[model samples]
Target: MSVNSRSDREREHFNALATDLGSVWWGSITKAGQLRLDERAKLAIRYGGLSPGKVVLEPGAGNAEFTKRLATSGATIVGVEISPNQVAIANERLIEFPKAKVVVGDINKLDFPDGTFDAIVGNAVLHHFDLITALPEMLRVLKPGGSFFFTEPNMLNPQIAVEKNIKFIGRALQNSPDETAFFRWQIDSILKRNGFSRIWVKPFDFLHPGVPDSLIPFFQKFSHFLSNIPVIKEIGGSLQIYAQR
Candidate 1:
């Protein structure tokens, strides 16, 4: 097969995995894992400068889990997703939150007017996109003084490194060839190049998939402690990035 055909097929592979993502992905996470997700959303929303009545855009909003959490802050959120399947799921999940809505749309081709959003946020979605193309579009739609915040896998993590670099494991984890984890320097450079300022990149997350529920608090404390030490923190699970447009 030609290179382009292979690439297209791989793209389809990931998208197919995405359709059933919430059912398989979110449902399988442990309670500690769930709490960590909620914490990340809280931190991202705060750093993104979201406030009551402010408008925020969340791209790649699968199931609206993060979006629903952000809505707890009393902000108006629009979750844009490419899969109609996920959109429906997000809508259903967010039905009780009148302030949040999910719409079917591509992040690269956002239909909203320029400078229309107070902020843009996402969780585990940034790496699925080409920053070169997506960041500029995000900047265009964001109002001046608006912020962009999200959490992504830290490429420096040992387990993440193994998953991404190993072919069979990566595929099993549904990591397509097009997907990538982000390093702090890379995120810093991209945001700067895209005309963003006040960029903040923090690495956090210590609980693992295999850790027992009772040990989660102990692990969480240890993890946060490790993330504070220089060089050691690079191996933490996720990188939270906040930048002003």
Candidate 2:
């Protein structure tokens, strides 16, 4: 299998957002954005298995917002973003961090040689393409025993469902033209087919945007509360995963 190419619409959408997250209604560091970042940090620590001296590759580094944070792990992180504009921004923003470097590259056609990295990671990125093909390409590049981890939105969530499934509504919500969320079973099947073992999946989050920061602490607890509820667990917010090649 080979890396998939980006669609023209997908390239345009991301390039525009790369100019600035604020250009998109949903990508900015609003209250919800902060919450999302916090969750990503927690997921990385608990599942990423990143450690000092390990070399990690982050595809779709997106202006390095999460990439900069990943640097805190004391790992050598090479962030490869496909959008040149976003890569420029990431380089500028990451200047202060010695452990991190951002470059413009495609996730489907990664530039590295086989087994060059200890791990491969992402955040809200895998849903952009048909993972059935992409995962094999990734496995080919990753070292034996190298891990893959990331968090992605759950399509079953009401807000996400409408935004992604409805054409006009998705545009209004700034859902990327080429992106789609995933379900647990679907993802598990994809990983298993790609030869990933020891797969771990956890669902969490319930809070949406517009919640004031002052109330975030309260709502965060409430979000986890709802995540534990039977059927509600599947539609809360995002799915966190960790798997090895």
- Candidate 2 per-residue lDDT over residues 80-174, each given as its tens digit: 87667777778888888888998877666678888888888878878875576567778878889988998888877888888778878988877
Best by lDDT: 1
Per-prediction TM-score to the true structure, in the order listed: 0.90, 0.92
What is the lDDT, from 0 to 100, of the residue 70 in candidate 1?
89
Per-residue CA lDDT of model 1 for 47-151, tens digit only, reads 887789799999878667778888988889998876666667778889899999989876766899999999999888888776667788899999999989998
Off by over 4 Å in 1: 1-15, 18-28
Q: What overall lDDT, based on C-alpha atoms, would model 2 receive against the true structure?
A: 0.78
lDDT of 2 at 148: 91
Task: Please give the CA lDDT of all the candidate structures.
Answer: 0.80, 0.78
